[model samples]
Each structure stands twice: as C-alpha cells, then as structure tokens.
Target: MQVTNQPIDAIHEEVFADTTSGIGPELNLINPQPESCRQISAESPVLSNIELAKLKNIPDFEAATIPMLYKVADGGAGLKQALDAIFAAADKYIAEGKCILILSDRGITKDMAAVPALLAGAGMHHHLIKNGTRLRASIIIESAEPREVHHMALLLGYGVSGINPYLAFESLEHMCADGMLDISFEKAAENYISACTHGIAKILSKMGISTVQSYRGAQIFEAIGISSAVIEEYFTGTPSRLEGIGLDEIAKEVAMRHEPAFAEQNIDPFSYESGSHYQWRNGGEQHMLNPETIVKLQQACKTGDYKLFKAFSKQLRGSAFANQNLRSMLTFTP
Candidate 1:
C-alpha cells in the first residue's frame, strides 16, 4: 500500500507491504498520525504488524550472540564459531518451538572480530533450509553490519525477515547531536527506515514483484569472486559465472577487520582503513585501473607494440588486483 513514496510524507502515512493475513485493510496496524521511533528495533525493523511490545517479551525472542574473538587471528576460528552457533540456534529454535531467532553481533570488546552479518545470515538461512528448519522461526538480525539499502536488500533476499541497523541509528543520533540533522532523532530514524523500505520496494519492483514475501529466500543474486564450493554449501542455488575466492580468502578478508580491532597496539588513527578500490592509493583496496596499468597501456599505445599491449593485458588478467572483477576471470570457450 504505497500511499506516498516521498520520504517525509510517507512517514506520516502508514505505508507498508501486506503483513497481516486474513485481516481487513483498516485493521492492519496502520498508523495515520505522527509517532515516535518505537517501531524501530532489532526485531522486525520492518514491522510485521505482529507487535512484540515490552522488554518482558524478549524471553520468546531467542538470541544467538556472535563473538568477535577466536582462537586464531585470521578470523577463521571466530567465524566458524559464529557459524556453528547459528546452525545450533536453528536446531534450538526448532526444539524449543520458538517463533523468532535473533542473530546479534553486539558483543563488542577491545579483542573481538565480527563475522560479516551477510555471510552469517545467508549461511544460516541455507543451513536451516537444508535441514528443513527454514520456516521454524523468522530470522531477525540486530547488528551494526547493515547500514545501506544494498545490505538490507541482500539480507532480505537471502532470507532475513527483520533487520535493526543499530550502528546507523547511532550515527544518525551523532549527526543530530552535531546539528547535521534539522529533525528530531525519531524523525531521522523514521526517514531512514522509510528510505530503506522504499529502496527495497524499488528493487523488488525491478524484479516485477510487489511484495517482500515473494523476494524472501529467492537467492536472486549472482556471485562474482565467491567460489563454487562456498555458493553450493552456503549460498545454494545462487549463480556464480566466474568463481574466485573460497573460505581461506574469506577468512583473510574478515581478519583484515578482526586483527586491527583486536590488536594489542591500537591503530594510531583508531579508524577503519581507507579502501582504494575507487582510486589508487599506496596500499589500499585494489582497482583494475591503476597507475601501473595506465602506464603500461599508455606505453603500449604510444609505441604501437603488440607485446607491450599483451603485457598490459596480461597484467590485467594475471595481477591479483585485476582479478577482482568477473571480466578479468573470463576465458574464451571453444
């Protein structure tokens, strides 16, 4: 029921996809007037119209806490632990007859690393599906991992019913404190939720689907660099045209954040590393088009040398940085 898609106006209106079943339109938990951000929470951020009011209801919401620290530094141990916990939570939910499973990565300390919520969520979803427990409980994630529309879409696409972007709300609060936002925190949060829900609706609309329920567990995404084994075991049925990294690579990537956060000697800046995937940096996220690649291409063109051009092309295919894209991994099929 998209009364209005405009951000501010939409917040005032009760515009949500159908949640309640066998209920009349008027009784579908519609909020006509302005309200607080009480609707926003770790569980059912996209409110299901089945409200879980009061803190006492937490007993029904089984929590699966993800840890940051592990026995190994490369984040393999930590990630493995989290994955095991998620799978275990699936079983626990089934055994206990629970309605909701909340996977949270909020156990933050000086010595902890986060298992990527997307990876964790998708893995759990697939695991539960394999074991015939996907519908046992609705998956709700309360974490700082998701902040953008892409994240939310991917989460829902892979089988997440609810998401509470806690960190984003904190950031919005900071912005409001610094006078960056002219509206109240509740209004900012409402606008943010509205934007995310609207963005999700647009994505689904592109797929010619009107409801989020149809998009849920659809796995309508293709992997570029992720390996076949990972897709088969974790992200089953998702297409991967050019398989790339596997578990080891994933662990190393997680370690990139984990190690820094848990390091004995704090990073001098105490900030996340800047990625150079967009523009080249001394030692940053790799990009296919960099100074060396550009220089090689320029030299090859200037001298009209096929060998130089071959070298340039070779660099594009051979170099680790260049292989980040699927195009670099493509080969001629005879």
Candidate 2:
C-alpha cells in the first residue's frame, strides 16, 4: 500500500495559505453591523484593527450587550494587581449592562505564559455569574493552529465566551513586511481573522454545535492532566481526570518561559523567542512542525506505512507539536 507524492507539506501550506481572497465577503460575519449585533469599543491604546480585528460581532447572538475590551499585564507579581483592576472594571461594566468582557492577550509573550491570568479572568467572570451578574468572558490570544484552537476550547469550557487569535494576524504582518506575502497588512489581518473564525467554527461543529453562543461556558471538555486543586478554584465545575500540576506549578512554568525574555532584554527591548511564529527557526521557540519532523511525517505519509507514520507521530506526541498542530486529526489505527 504505497502512498503517492508526499502531500504533508502541500497540505500544511494549503491549510495556512493566504486567505485574503475570501476576507472581504466575510467581513459581515466577522464584524456584524450595529443593527445586527450591539457592538462597543473601549477607548484604549492597543493594537489597531489594521493589525488585527480584535472585536467580533455576531448577529442575533444571545448576549444583549457588547463586550468591553480589557488589556492586562502579561505575567509577573503585577499580574495580581492588574487582575484586581480588571475585576473592578468588569464589575462597573456589568453594572452598566455591558454583559461581555474581552480579555486581550495580544502583545504577550509567545509561550502563552498568560494562561494563569486567563484563568484568573475566568474565575472573576464566574464569580460575577455566581453573584447573579449577567455577564460573559471572551479572550483574544495569540493562537495560530488547530491545537491552539483546542486550547481555546478548553478556555471556553472553563468560561470563555469567544476567542480571537491575534498571532495569526501578526504572522501575516511579518510575512508581508518580509515580502514573503504580497497582501497589505489590513487585508492579511482580515484574512487571518476569517481563518481563525473558520477554525473555531469547525471545532464547535464537531461537538454538534451550530453556533458559538451555544458553546459559551458549556464545559464540554474533560481535563486529562490538570490538578484537582487548580480545577476546583479557577475551573470550578470542570472535571479533571489525572492529578496534574497545581497553580504554583503553573506559575513556575510561566516564570521559566519568561526568564529568557527578561534576561536578554538589555540586548533587545522587543526581543522574542525567534522562530516562535509561523516560520520554524532554530534557537527561537518550540514548534511541532520543524523541518526534520515535517520531512519524516511526509515520508511516512508518502510510503503509506502505518508503522512509519506511527513512529513519527509518537515522536510528535511527545514534542511541543502535540499542542500546536492538528495531531488528533491524523490518527491511524494501523
């Protein structure tokens, strides 16, 4: 059962191909008109929609009010203070009948060290809900791939109402700036947003859901490897299978990832883990689809050898690629 030409690379390229061609037509779905859905903008200094459309408006959504965007510090001791302020702000907004809060994690680090903050935000949202405050929570993260989408779904199960993957937009900007992409920044951003929306929609569809509103805070997922203590606190009501790392462990993990950024700050203020984005480069960030692994997976797929594919996939499951690519979709029993 020999397979044909290796299509893994081609499939990867196609999955992330330029989406500019279909963006304009999807604007109505991405940013619904005020009449279609109540929309609000928080007057704040942040990434311009020219870089990424952070706001999402769906017509006839369940929510009666639009969300107020809130940006907070990425991580550190200051994170607690920032979350306190965010909670206060959310209280005010909820009192004012703004039932949705958009927690923006753009301009954050590549490792997603802000997961703790996201959990804290979810906790606050749940607190409000418990106190009879009618409100919802959404997140704007730097997610890119299908695995990232699954992570977002986890957040949704933990109380996230919506998600926007701004990293996809930033990747587009970088590609266009590097001349690897021919589209303008705005067009690329639009296309990226559309792509993320499509990805999220597909995830929901798999669960027999037809709309994002229905999926909000549904807790439709099970945490396989997370601590019960952490789950009890931030992810209340959510079930965890294995006893995993706790909040302290999570904080330590985030600190470890942030250490390099702080240590090398003097060398470059805007320094980041190189190759953490769309392109895979050495000594930058962790990625699943590196040249070596992609080559191996491509070879296995081309040969139609299930055993070969399994070997490559076993390696992938143990690597960072497990959380960044659509590895679940590549299952082969043989």
Candidate 3:
C-alpha cells in the first residue's frame, strides 16, 4: 500500500544499473532485453529482487493488463527449477533493492519461511532486512482461483485499515504476465475462492460451527442450540475484505441449514431414524444431505458411481464442477 510515484523507468534502471556493472557470471546479471528497456524502468521502491523476478515471469509479463495468475506444477522438481529460472531472469532487475510482492502456491509457501536462503540467493545479507518498515514484504501461499483473484484485486484496491491487497495481486499478476507460471487466470481465481471457502469451513468446523450461515449480524449459524443470528454477527463483524465479494451465495446455503424452518421442512419417508431427511443440528447440514445419504453418495461417486455422482452433482447444482469440493473429497486416495 505504501508506494511512491517514482517513475517506473527510473526505478528499473537504478535497480539494473548498479548490478549490471562488471558482471562476472551468467548467474550474476540479467541481460536486459530490448523489450524490457522500452518499458517502465522504476518500480515501487519496496520490492525485493526475488519478488520482482517472480512478477516478471508471469505469463505475458510483457503486456499483462488483467491480473496475472501463476500455476505451480504439482509434485516434481518443476517448482524449484521454475523459481531458480525466475530468480536468474530478474537478478539484475531486482538488484536495485526495490521491494516486490510474491504470492505463491501452497506447495511453495514453505519456501517463504526460509528467508535466509531467499536473501542469500538475491545476493543480500540477512541483517540488511532487519528494519521492518524499510524492508516490508508479503508472501501469502493462499488458495488461488478466478473468483479469489478477482476478490483479491478488489481488496487490494480497497486498502482498508493498513491491509494492502494489491501487493500480492501485483506480484501474482507480474509473475503470470512474465510466463513463469503455467496457470490460467480463471483457474487461479477458482482455486483461490475454493481455498477461502473450504478454509473457512474447516476453521468453523473446528470451532464446532460447521456452517457459515450469514455474513451480517447472525452469520455462521451453528447447529444444535446456538443461534444463527449470532453467527451472522460474527461473520459480518469480522472485517475480512473477502466478506461480500464471492461468498454471499455460499453463506446463504450454509446458513439455511441452521434455520428453524430447515428442521420443519426436512421429512423422512423411510422407516429409519435418518429416513430421507437431513438435519443440521447433528452436523447434517455441514453436508448437503443426510449423513446416511452422503455415505451412499460417496460410495456411488467412487466405484464409477456415475449414476449417483451425476444425480448428486445435479442436486448440488453443479458444485462439483464449480468448486470441486465434493469431487476432491470423494476422489482422494491413500
């Protein structure tokens, strides 16, 4: 959020100029391409070399207008190699000691914790970053999705309190524009949204409130004897920038289960205690159907249970495709 109107071209040159002098090795300097020379030289003063490198590698980095989304390939030396390449690419550009933002996939998040290595790779000493305000940087290894990206873009624009969402988005966008990642904007946005929703659901379940029923005065209504109204208040009061963006519909469905009306509406046709009805009081609402029904649905989805998965997918109105939450849980293997 803290940025100076320092000309982008000036910033770029200052960063590369000092480092480009008397370059001793290929790994030490980036050969500034002519295309890069014509673009903005200066960047926001706060970005780090590594962060800028990641941004520069985003797909279509040269002309990225929309938000960028980078994909970290699953389970290979691919991620490490990609990181190395990006660093190599930006070594000179970022050497100017500019601050840069970096948003990575969850898989690479652990790497951020190893600050020492990052500093070393950027040819800087650890102690140099001791000043908090001067070296301010953010590394978030959060879920990525199209909706999440869009929401993040909006949040970055909002700049509430002291939280600046744009740094993360800019890092991500730059990386995407630069072609360092193999992910698409839409897919990234979807993944981001799914991460947020599922993450919140997971957090709520741990708190014994499995459903998020509202975002205003009585959001996140719980099962059992808890009041749905209180949960709504909690959610609305939380002040998360993500509150109203892409989660309204999800909240309504999750909250509906806790409503007294849901209890009355659910009816069982079979003679069993669970019958055909699902109740939210006993974590039933956490799921879209009765627990007993879900058990069968899980089985059906697994063993080529196309008939069941299809029907269930229909009932859930294609959430399987949009969110893939159920599909992931059911397809998961040991």
Candidate 4:
C-alpha cells in the first residue's frame, strides 16, 4: 500500500488535462454518448438525454440508432435466442452500413456475464464482416461497472468498442439527491463520465496504445483465476495465467450473491451500504479512506509531532488510505 509521491487525483487531473489539450493524438479525440443520455428528466437528479445530446452536438457526434440487446429471462437457451435475434438485426443494420451497435442490460440484475458472452458471440458471428472488411459498427456496453472497471476493460479487450457505466451514474444521482454531493446533477454526471473516460484512456495508454479503437480486442491481459475451458469457450483468445474455476463456478458465485436479495420475500426500505464510499465498513468491501487512521493523521499534523506523523505515514502506506485523494495534501519534509 505504498502511496505514490504524486496524488492519484492530481495525476488523474493532469492526465485529463493532457487528454483535453490534445497533448496526445489519442487523447480526447472521441467521447461516446451513454445510453442514459436518452432519458428525459425534469425533477430527476440526473442529466436528461436532451442536455447530453446538446453536449454531444458540440463535437458533431450524433447519437445514432444503436440497437440494444437485453438479457432474456431464461438461462443459456434464452440468452442464445436473444443473441440470435440481435445478430439477425445486426446483420440488417450492417447491411445498411450502420456504424455502431449498443448492448444494454438496463433492467438486468442477474447473469451479468451474459453481456460479455453475447459480445464474444457477436465477434464470432460472420455477419460482423462484409466484403472482407470487418463491419464498421462498434459495440458499446451500456450496463456495466457495479462490479469492477477491470472487468469493463476485459470486455473492451474482448471486443467491446465503448462502455457506459450506468450504475456509477445512478450512484452519483443518488448522492446528489441525498445532499451528499453539492454539484448539479448534470455536472456530476459529466464529471463521472469524464473520469471513466480518463480511466479507459489510462488503461489504453498503459498498453502503449493511444486510441480506444486499437485497444478493442487487444487482449493484453492474462486472467489469473479463470479456467482454460471457460477461456476457450467464451473468453476466446484471452490468456488465463492461472487455471482456476470454470463457467459453472463463476455462475455459482453470481448465484450466491443473487440469493441474498432473492430470498427477501417481503419488500422493505433499502439503506445505503454503511461507509459506502471513501471509507471501509465492517463486512463490506475495502476502501481507500480509514476513519480511525485519518483521525490519527490529523492529530499528528496538529501537534507537529514528526515522530507521530512518520508513524501515521507508515501506517497509511500500509492501508487502503494510500490511494485516497487526501493523500495528495500530505507532504513529507525530511
């Protein structure tokens, strides 16, 4: 947990600035429109489609009719049917020379892997090519990132052209509505989407690629805990460094997570996870900010105790707080 000398936020801001300034030919060249931009909202705490559309128009990026394929109710069979239908429709669109396709999981809560599976299946389909040229249509993912951005990158490496982190946008909307965030809904949404785009850019840059198009299906990563069989059947061409679980194991993990909510027979009011962001909660996933450690760090700074500050710094360097934005404010003078 050694903290970088430069703060993560500052690094991100610099990268974002560079991206916007066109410092690199790949930076800020193209920004994809999220599916949420289609919704019209008056009192809602999220940017309406109209506003985002206006922004998109500034860059001359028209929102095209990107067909959405949602997850079906039945298991694999249902998914296959849905994929077939989507591919069929895609063939029609490609024949018409459409430039993009969107796959959405707006109301889907289970079998989230189906989205990537469908994407892989689409990549395998012959209709994606015409006249010995790959169909120019890009596949954008619209329902992702309640899990991990790495997973999103994995999808991108597999064949996904763009990503719209809908869940993260919804979370920002909730935060604004609950007074946890002070910014306007539009700004929050914009900032969050910008951050996500920056992240994607960073991921691409790491692989020495400047553009998202090149990053698509680059397959630069090696999976650690997925089985070879699953990789071969579904996540084809992606290397699995360590052989582990198969698709059944992955589905079992998904089922275990789903069972908790499904078992709740009576509807009850929902509460946000304690320490939802910026802090770690008991029985919850880890976060970068630790309340107790932050308090101690503040105390050390107030008292001007160099020894105490060093101790606190050492402690922080070992915990998740090393990555927290507050780390930028800490300057070590030795």
Relative to the true structure, how large is the alpha-carbon lDDT of every model?
0.66, 0.51, 0.31, 0.51
Segments in model 3 whose C-alpha atoms lie over 4 Å from true places: 1-75, 87-92, 101-291, 294-334
Model 3 over residues 1-334: C-alpha lDDT tens digits? Answer: 0122232232223231111111011121155555433322222212233534554464432311111122222212332334444343333323443333233322323212111112112211111222222122212222222123223222222110011233345555666677865786545534543444444333333333322221101222222222333223212222332223222332333233223323445556342234223353462224455454577688886787788777765766545344424344355558
Judged by whole-model lDDT over C-alpha atoms, candidate 2 comes out at 0.51
Measured over all alpha carbons after superposition, the RMSD of each candidate to the real structure, in angstroms, is 8.0, 11.4, 21.8, 11.7
Worst 10 residues of 4 by lDDT: 20-29
Worst 10 residues of 3 by lDDT: 19-28
Off by over 4 Å in 2: 1-85, 96-100, 105-117, 136-147, 265-334
Off by over 4 Å in 4: 1-85, 109-133, 144-148, 257-334
The sequence of per-residue lDDT tens digits that candidate 1 reaches over residues 98-138 is: 64666667766555556678887888889887887665556
Q: RMSD of model 2, in Å?
A: 11.4
Full ranking by lDDT:
1, 2, 4, 3
Task: List model 4 lDDT by residue over 1-334, tens digit each.
Answer: 0113332342444442222110001212255345323321212112234433342343323233333333333444444455566666666765665444555555544433333433443343333532333434455555543234465566666665445566677777889999999998889877765655567656656555554545555677776777786566556666676688754454454444444554546645365344354447776765544666677778888998888778777776774555445455478999
- How many residue pairs clash in each candidate at the backbone level? 1, 2, 57, 1
Quote model 3's TM-score: 0.20
User: Considering lDDT, which of the candidate structures 3 and 4 is the better prediction for this target?
Assistant: 4
The C-alpha TM-scores of every prediction are 0.69, 0.54, 0.20, 0.55
Worst 10 residues of 1 by lDDT: 19-28
Better of 1 and 4 by TM-score: 1
